[model samples]
Target: MIKDRFSDDDDGLQPLAYNMSHDEGNAANTETLHLNVLEDVHIFTTQFELTHKLNVIQKAALLLQSDTSLDDAPGLSVHEITALANETTHKWQQPWTMYLTIVVTALGAIGQGWAQTSMNGANLYFPDAFGIGSGSARDNFTVGLINSGIYLSNGLLGAWLVAPLNNAFGRRGAVFAAALVSLLSNIGGALTQNWQQLLFFRLILGCALGVISSTLNIFAAECAPAVIRGGLAVSWQMFCAFGIFVGFIANVAVYDFGSNAWRLQLAAPFLSTIPLLILIYVCPESPAWYIKNNDHYDRAFLSLCRLRNTEIQAARELYQAYLQQSTKHDSKDKLTYFKTLTELFTIPRVRRATVAAHTVMISQQLCGINTTAFYSSTIFLDANFSKYSALLASVAFGFINFVGAFPAVWTMDTLGRRSLLLLTLPLMALTMLAIGLSFSIPADSPAHFGLLAAMIYLFCAEYSPGLGPVPAAYSAEVFPLSHREIGTSSAVAVTSLWASALSLTFPTLLNTLGSQGSFTLYAALNVVAFVLVFLLVPETRMKTLDELDEVFAVPTRSFIKYQLTVYIPWWMKRYVLRRDKVELPPVEGWRTEEYQAVCQNEE
Candidate 1:
């Protein structure tokens, strides 16, 4: 009699469990397939679940929140359930990692800026401090060459090295490597005599720096809980702001040194050592990497607890759950370097996500954000401000950028991805139009209208929160969890290339097209981007990867849902109906009311 009762219960969960099962041939025991069906139902039925986030993590998080102890947790294996739940549901605060990582990244970027800034700013202090030999052509060539090196290293090599470096050295290792290379490069830049030598070393330094830029983002995501990921990731912009803050002070203090001012400016970036040490001592390796190494579960658990400042056994349960999810996402599949390379190309979602990441990156750079950032000092100089005031304004740009980034970060989980990205183009384009128009006026135009210059600066501030961070966030997300590392490296690589192009060309482009023409062209491209955002992109905010996968994996053609069959693109279809496969009889009227009874009977 009991055997017959259990059989009826099995019929209840068969529909949603279909894809979850390993084989279509196994029509048998479909009830056991989903493993999470009952779990998910229990969760969504609760009030705590975010209406926005209705996926496995949300379910697990809700489940753990209700359960008091690991032994009492309503699941087998407390370790696994707890880790996954805490990241999605229980939000814990830890500044050790978040603050340190941001500071370290910020300091590292300053070192990179020193390589370019004062020397370029030479046009101000010692007009002949470093003379440009010829007329416009020679001056343009020198600036163009310096820009080229920055682009090639970051664009071409940075992308290629990001994955291997991270995999081989771990995130910490990569950052350490960047610091060491930066130390050497800053020293070399300070000591160099010729333009060609300085350019070569700067490019080398840029390549090394590029590696750090590409990987730090992925590191931030893997370490942070989903709730705080955006907040933590935006720390880079803060650090970047601080770097500018420090650089401005350093530039002004040493301007009296004439040519020597450039050397002090060059070496100043390595001063980020204080934060770098904190990161090295306290920051934990990603728990995801521990699972990747197989059987290091205990160490992995401790790392999470330490990072989150949680109790050990309590952290263990959560770490285990996280391990399982991470496992599902980052399958070992013989994690060979070569295998990593080929899988990125062979996987469809991986390829698509990579393309999206790359496109977002190219657009951010080509849209003229970096050039605007790079040349702001020049623009201020052109406005007839004293060099120190221009330096002050450059530092101010960092603060505005930092402040601007907070809105995007706060809204990322609240607002949809498509909406954030779509909204960017219109606002960004208008700002650029103002910038170009400001430059269109005669040289004698009063500094009072410099509000337009402020708008150009505002455009950059706007870009980071919107388009600036989008590419990195997208790279960390877009692919199926299984190939995320490889997929992201590839996506970032393309962007690195785009960064290189921007660095190399922008100086020349600015000179050739002039500010009015340059920004006008980019503004026109923003219109096309606005259209693409509406036509192709889907909302990603407040949703899980699995939800995104379900949403995007479908064909963007006709979709038929029961009577309310609203027309949606094939890609937007949330559920798949296997027409060739069998369908279970409806849960009848009891599908809703009978859930508790049916599940209770199964137990």
Candidate 2:
């Protein structure tokens, strides 16, 4: 392989054969006492201590099997690690890889997109024929429930299904399943004879979309090597933005043509699959998933090259990491569903990151993305927009959200997390208040102008640049690798709870209090959330996941303080920082030969 490379780069690193299973295993174990370059890589014979010895692959496998924390590792700076990671990861979003992700994403989006439109007919316009009239207080409540049902259901079912299925079917299979669910469920909703039937399809659609949303993110992450993960994952989020946009467009189109528009609307998302399905036939699955689990090294390596757009030799670092993860699957206890969550919380850094991530996500919903997405059409109609004009206004919300993701993708590595959140939260709160205030004129008053339309577009569009992508990104990144699945799931779960509660109840609340009261409450929540984010959330951009463990291994007043304490104060982050230096996490204490059997018991 290139005649023992690194010849030009004088870094004193050496490669060793990565095998542990052998007849001389006992002899190797006795010699497993590793040497350390003490305080700063100096050879320290005195500090050497006896510890459980693991082979190179075993140590590397710990990279994947460990929690999401990347706060510490040997021989690399935190910024260097994060930069390398972001560059490699975001590559999955390139035209080729992204097309696959988008196609798979459509399978999930179909159900969600259709659900968004199911209530527009009854919600937007009262019947103009015969005795049909404007909806009273009760009709608004009924229509609102129909609108918000999907967001609520996605969060509830996502945690329960996506992880389990992803673990079972590989990322591609899970996403494919979601798309199939969408195709059937959307058609079902379109044909439903009554609201109950529509609601049932809506909930099913939510579950399907949740499955897709959760898995596709991990899918995008895995399919990507290391360079382009952020941009690609954000693209997946951007697709969701447009999914809502497509929902708005369906409402406008149907309103323009048909009288009973809801039927036509429910079928809109199914049409998105035409191009998406074609891509899936050709898109490669996650190489890490394939290599680690299926033991198909040749295919996984080829896919990795395509994913990274580089030669296989250049991808040695990632390949080695995959090897490390595989060793864990062979040697460690199987990660059961319940214990998975237990480890997520019990670990110090993971728990901290989970709280931080969940806070940002919960705040995003509290910022009113759902109310704006689900109710903007109704609001425009109430504000005196023409039949199809309101739908156009609603579509504008989705457009802003879609475009809003760009700046975040560009700046995520450069500007860091806390700076963006601090920058966005206050403005989001203020803009939301402004939208509420513009509609305060009494219905009979001359001041009842059409500023509501302008206010909403401004509110939805501007808030998106900062808050739209930030919460989603923070929610995913702030967790350690080990607990990433469970920790992020918990955060998403909390956000979903609020999203569902708001979606299910907002219409009734709006009718009872009037638009002024409803909007005002949303604005107030934004203010409270803004305060919480500023005081609590840490700057995580450009920091390795393990280094974050060093920074936040313990509680602190703020993220900066955590960083300071972890590094500067007393080697306080010792446990997370020096994982190789510490005792290994408690696995089943058994002879090496019994390793696979212990995992079998858990499985």
Candidate 3:
């Protein structure tokens, strides 16, 4: 009966003859047998039904001797077969290069964070240095324009400019270029004589930030093992929070510098960038990118060995697996930049991923994070706090933001991306509502200020875990390896555009709508973000980049219909008409002709 279930018709469990002989006459047979075993093992493990009896039987067969017949040899028990499979599937220890890569990328993220948040505190003093009256409309508009310039260049340069750089020179080169620009921009900004010159330098710095932000997470994701990829990739945001924290500290340290304080604050970010430039040069190029884009198989294999802590054979096999999966979606011919960009929208799964990436980026910005981050001190100042007290509150907020990000690194893989977003979005919404409502109380009341401070801290805590890191991690994970650079660039571009709009408009909104209306608008936007994430974004935790392709390639209508049938309550299903049920073909199977040929040749 057991044999009947694993009959010859079950191609997955075909019998294999082991060839352990060292004799010259049997060398051909031994090679053929080795290839057969490798192919069968690959197919069996990749299947979904891991616990099938036939699957266990196949594993048992793999350990058999060539001279012994199945009938003569003692059959392995189910427990023994399961143990073998588990042993086979266990991952190797990650290499030191993996950790090194994480550190290098996080450093780049710190530079980006410094560039973004440095302006937040410096804006407070800009009016004094620029000779504009405090609280004047012209001063507010100028500050907004300076902040908006960074984001505007981030959108344009990240999407169109940095993408090709990533493709041309690899992640390390891109980061190096970004660091150089940041160094120059910060020095230029610090030495500027007027607001106009400072704005120009800030715009240049934004372009550098765009390159760093768009590429660093992708580099981390590509370099890490799949088991911990989410944690490592999301570490970019943690470093970003760290950078912001450092900026806040810099502001506090230089607060007494008077007119020159802002200049010191602007230049402080270079401390992070200087080390980043050197370390990035020491890091290796992404193995996946090397294999796929550059056609340097030997170098890719070596890089894989270093990154995964495995031997040459294992590295080669793994790289081949990655190449096979990628080739299924990528074109055989070389893709130009425009063609790659077009493929992001033209391909079905890619298009869905792009939509999800863009939505998450846009939603994160529209949630009013930039407004809150860039103007927290100003917000407190408006609440009747002294300048020193407001700056202290900003420092506290930055600390909370940095600490909050640590939990996501622990929970991101366990909680799943969609789950984290869903869990946090509503809480963020409520927190914003609380902050808005606090403004309704008299500004002179201690209760009003206390509630406002507490709510702002709570909001930062809630936001850092999900909205801050998950979007960047998710966007990096969702795209195909061939298009990951452009896809992530596009997502960052959307973030910058939305950030630009918010940065440019938030001051005006605060002036016109008052604190209550501004906060309420953010709260409502969070509510809408919740709905979009719930409906569209898919779970991507603990999955490899290639596996995500199949996840998104499943037809949307069919997936929705399946969800309605299986997840919806029976009572709810009864109200739905059978005519409305979507009837679509099942997902196209993953096995390609090339894979089949390889399997057949081995057999």
Report per-prediction Cα RMSD to one decimal.
Answer: 12.5, 11.9, 10.1
| RMSD in angstroms between candidate 3 and the native structure over all alpha carbons | 10.1
Tens digits of lDDT, candidate 2, 2-48: 12211122232332232233224335532232121111111111122
Q: Using Cα atoms with residue i matched to residue i, what is each candidate's TM-score against the true structure?
A: 0.73, 0.73, 0.79
lDDT of 1 by residue, 1-603 (tens): 011111122222321222333334544544352345445533432433222222332223323443234443332234454554565565544547555655555666555544445444443532234566342766766765664566667666766787778777877788778767766776787677767777877777877777776667666666666567756655655555445556666777776775567667766666664456356546777666665555454455556665563343334444345535644645465567778678666554454455455567666666776666666676677666677777777767656765676676676666645567777788898888777777766757674347665886678677767886566676677777666766776776676576666655666677788767877887887776765555444455665776766444422221112112232222234335434343332222223444445434433
State the lDDT of candidate 3 residue by residue for 208-325, as single tens digits. 8888877777777767766556557678899899988888888888888877888888888999989888888777787766755646655664576677543422333443455365
Candidate lDDT values, in order: 0.58, 0.59, 0.74
Q: Rank the candidates by lDDT, best first.
A: 3, 2, 1
lDDT of 1 at 127: 23
lDDT of 1: 0.58
> How far out, in Å, is residue 433 in model 1?
1.6
